[model samples]
Target: MAESRNEPADPIVRGTFATAKQSWADLFKWKQRVAVTNDYGETYCEWQSPRPLRNPISLFAQLSARDWLFFLVGLAAWTADAFDFHALSIQTVKLAKYYDTSKTNVTTAITLTLLLRSIGAAMFGLAGDKFGRKYPMVVNMIVLGLLQVATIYSSTFTQFLAVRSLFGLFMGGVYGNAIAMALENCPVDARGLMSGILQQGYSLGYVIAASCNLGVGGSTDSWKTVFWIGTGLSIGVGLIRLLFPESKQFIAAKEAGGGHTSSSPRAFWIETRKMLAQQWRMCIYCIILMTFFNYFSHTSQDSYTTFMLTQKELNNAAASRASIIMKTGACVGGTIIGYISQWFGRRRAIIVSAIVSGLLIPAWILPTTERSLSATGFFMQFFVQGAWGVIPIHLNELSPPAYRSSFPGITYQLGNMISSPSAQIVNAIAEHRTVTAVDGQPAPAYGPTMGVATAIIALGIAVTTALGPERRGRQFELAKPAGVATADEIEVKGKLNDVESQVAVDGEKPDVGQMENVIVDDDDDDDEKKR
Candidate 1:
């Protein structure tokens, strides 16, 4: 009877060579039967059996259909955000020219926009956690679209700055909400790819904005036309999202009383306090590190590239064209890095990209002709600046589902808050390097100073890599499984069980509540029925 039960049923397995890799079932059975004997001449079986095979067909089908829709929504939102943000970069120089202001002053407008956007991101993140992602995303799109349209008619520098700053606030909400939507909707196996695809919208938006700037012609009205284009795009995205459904996870959370029900200010604060107290440390660390590196890359590349092009004496038209080219490189680089990170592992990919790009930064400082400078700038932006496209997805994975949006939003915004100032600082430093020649031409004094600053920041990042844990290929869940132990749990359990077994196996007194089985019925059940 034992021989019949143990007989190899599958001929494919029986005919395999001894050196062939073992099947999962064969390996699992072997592991179950093996027991290590201690010095005391006693052996014990491993607790818990292997899990049963899960049905992949149903899981794959559901994830495939749902994640695609989620990806589209994320893509649209991010693309709009990218268009709104990068459109302003080229426009800033134009704004400086039109208002008879210094580029430094114009750069301050960019800083204000970023600062306000960070505020929006943080606020909306909290709101998304409190309420839900869908409403905030829809509201932000409407707000940003209307604001972009309003930006077109601004006459004065203050008006433009105010409008853009307000737009930044709305833009901020889009990111956190969109990310939360994507993260919650995607399957575990495809989260990285979905996140990457969604983030590609930023790069794609840059491309679209650049094309618009170049295609529209760099008149004073050209920037305004670009803003109108952004408004239209945002409206389209908003309308598309209206047709899309809310996240299943979010809906389930709301049904389970895991989300807010009241609108009182005090109640809001209490909920915020609870979230912060529970996950503040992890949230803060991840946000600071990820955002610092992300913003550092973007500000250094996007802002500095425009600065460099203008310094090279390119006209607004030429510079805008060059900016478009740089943005193209960024798009390509972002797409490549996003996909590569999936294969190489997110942390390793980020570290490697940072290191390689850091090495390339010094090249920007090297003396080069206009052609060489443009080529080098494009390469740097594509590889170095593009590396940031993966951080959002990686950061999202590290956070728990309940606090996912809030945590990434806080971390991303806080990092942006710290790093946005670097743009102004870099501009200030670069300004110091400018010298007026005898012929009345302003010459660039520090050719590669921004690159040097970036390299230093990259070095800091290399040191801080230790602070982040490896989350690649790990399943993201609200809580770890209870009875189904992980490897880490098994090790800890073995240590505790060894101690407990020593007493129990030797007929010594057991500790209080040490028995495996314990049952307690709920008194509340009867009381609730009586009530």
Candidate 2:
């Protein structure tokens, strides 16, 4: 096995939140090192380095037909998940009025959904790992479709809450399975770009839901029609997935004896326990990264429109337009930044994006006019989601291949669970700082709350990402060594053929784990003296 400690240890140590301290010096320090050695025995060392940039177009060109198919299906499933989720959120007032209940009660349904999703993510993640990504995802979609339809027909607030809560469970499952299926089969070089595109499914779904609401929500109880539309789309995506074969990567892993050995539940749990023991640290790290990520996204976005409407005093039409602008920036930024991460390195790309996004918070929230708000929102999300675009690939690279579905999925959902209270926290803080409106009514100053929350979350993400390990361009496909019993321990599949083997002059192990297949072929020119 390759030694894993080639990269410099992160400065900000991770432990209990209360005990941890950020290393400000390390935050600005450049740590990457490049080395060169002479072929002839003249000097001890030679150093050369190449530019770390690559053409983005080549990222997509490297993928296969099957890779494209998997990416599309994965993107669609996640998009549908977003669509079904936001469908209820955008129509909360309508639902509350229809059911003759307080809006908070309706919002509680959203909370219930968030609270229960982690359970669903775990259960379905296990199923996907055990069975295959396809079937579990298909089942999740089907259930989501049924629940969405159920939500539409709910006659009582209790029924609506119950159905929506159930919807959250199935919704949680889709992300893990969808991302696993999409990126698992993808070429390693293309993963960053692909991840960027895939993550945008959420933004795309929001746009779709918004569009649907605009089209049908003018009449009384027209929100039901939106749910019906979301339902049909969910079922259609599930059926569409059935048309495709299981991910070749999953099939390969299964045939190579990756997951559980026996088809029994007992075996599944045993294997689960075994893998957990090996990957617990990685799991904790992933959950931490995801918590910051989720907070970064939700704190900035969930109350953005409210900030524009209540604080900036924009009307509904202006706020809606600004939202569109913001999400559009997200879609564009996620794709571009994801592509950039292929060359920039995942950690660097994410850190830079977070920092830039943090800097933009002032302009993002302080704008008084709708035009300024839209422009700032556009640029703000570009950086925010740009950082997010790398997450799917980043998580997959860190995950054990045997539990790719469960590991990333469960970690993501847990992060969601942890940050579920972000909006509430922001609301509470903003509500306490209410200002007198032009109409003599008290209104919360949402701008400053969002600005502060977004800035803090961005800085937190930067610290987490900088200190975190990266496996940029790590290979996803590797054959299990025979009699290995578990795929987790399987040796990386391919080797670098170009570099001739060279001994380490400094008697240090080469940074093998992080290198895709590139071995440093180095020879010390002063070898005789050294020897």
Candidate 3:
């Protein structure tokens, strides 16, 4: 006897593992919502389910060459951003000696950088949304390069802190712009894998910093060399961005909105206020999710080198080497887990990775010797960053319509602001407390401190991610105003000048009744397939 329909009714309620499992199956079996805009031009969206996940090559092949350029440049920019920040973090011990201050005091710079990033997120993120992703990022990247050099010449600790604070401000803007540019153009189904590879740019930057640190050997002045390298890298990325055109999605969205990103200050403020009104709850929820993630990474990573030095009794070179390997694991895990998330579902991927990483806390910290510690640390960060891989696409998916740059950027960095003291807190606790080490000697207890904090943070990430909203396979393409040609249909496709002129000539008041395709779809109106 065949059942009348193959699928069960949508779960009456949610928040259970069984429910989540059922929903995962539904992602494949049912027709997911496809975003559609009505004549009123409201942000409400009705979308269809996505096609099945494709191979990495197939997914990548769908992108135009223009898309690849944007993604690669965005990744390069993010990598440079990571290097600039990690230059200080990995050099904490030497910086302490150079400044003649305690490691806790030195981490204050990290705190300041994190604390003020929200401001940059608000300012630059809004600019990216309103103006475009290009110029704001150019300004941010170039300024960041200059700030790194300022870190080199500071004669006093206070001056160093000031420069780093400014650095944080500029740095705050990078993630939002970079991620938006990178993933905004990617295919809906491929974003999971693309996001994973993209996020590893951070880890890649960290690895570059560590490698440079290792090359210079352990010296009080060696950190400056790394900063100089960062200066060049940042400036180079800024220059490279000049060659690329603005994101096609951003263009389509603006054109869809009648030829401007926002036509006037009054309009921009009105839109911002309206978005805030509709999405306040989602905003608060994302901030909470990002808070847990920020804590997860900073607690586990920022002090690990110091932990090895103080508790495990490793030298600077050995510690740096192990760190390189650990983050290498981060790169590998992020890519693999990120790719898998495409088919597995975003929340499920993040939840499982977080849980496994939490369970691996013991193996991560217990090893005594260099080889053993390296192996353990590598495995530990694999899961730590595996969860992180999904963040770029996840945040983009959660962002409100037309505010991708500002919303995700602000929330993410706001989380950073809240968790700014993570490294400082870990250091303050570890430096003062003592626990038995693998050698049976009483040590600063760095391992215990990081382990407990990361475990709690991991659990928090899983729950927050589970409870939050996901818009996987949501569309970023918008309908063209009637009579306006699409990007492909442009006379000189992919040329910046040709596209702008076309937009200027063709974009005008549309017949609201005739308009089709919309980029900014906030909620799925009939998401029965994903239920």
Which number leads on TM-score?
Answer: 3
Candidate 1 — which pairs collide?
287-411
Models ranked on TM-score: 3, 2, 1
Off by over 4 Å in 2: 1-52, 100-102, 217-220, 257-264, 436-441, 479-531
Regions of candidate 3 where Cα sits further than 4 Å from its true position: 1-51, 257-262, 437-441, 479-531
Residue pairs with colliding backbones in model 2 are 36-46, 41-525
TM-score of 3: 0.83
Worst 10 residues of 3 by lDDT: 516-525
Across 1-531, the per-residue lDDT of candidate 2 in tens digits comes to 332344434332334342122323333434423221234422221112213555767767778888888889899999999888777666655665688875445667767777778889999888887778888888889989998878878788778778877888888898888998898878766677789999999988877876787677345588889888899989999999988887787767556643633245665677678877766767888999998998898788876766666776766556667777888999999999988887666787899999999999888876677788889899999999999898998898878767778888889988888887776777668768986554557889777788888888889898887766655554556432112334322222222322223324445554565353332212232244369
Note each model's CA RMSD in angstroms: 12.7, 11.1, 9.1
Question: lDDT score, residue 21, model 2?
Answer: 28
- For model 2, what is the error of residue 245's alpha carbon versus the real structure, in angstroms, after optimal superposition? 1.0
Provide the TM-score for each candidate, comma-separated.
Answer: 0.73, 0.80, 0.83
lDDT of 1 by residue, 334-431 (tens): 66676566655566556666777778776665633455666776777776645676766777766755567766776776677666666677667777
By the lDDT metric, which is better: model 1 or model 3? 3
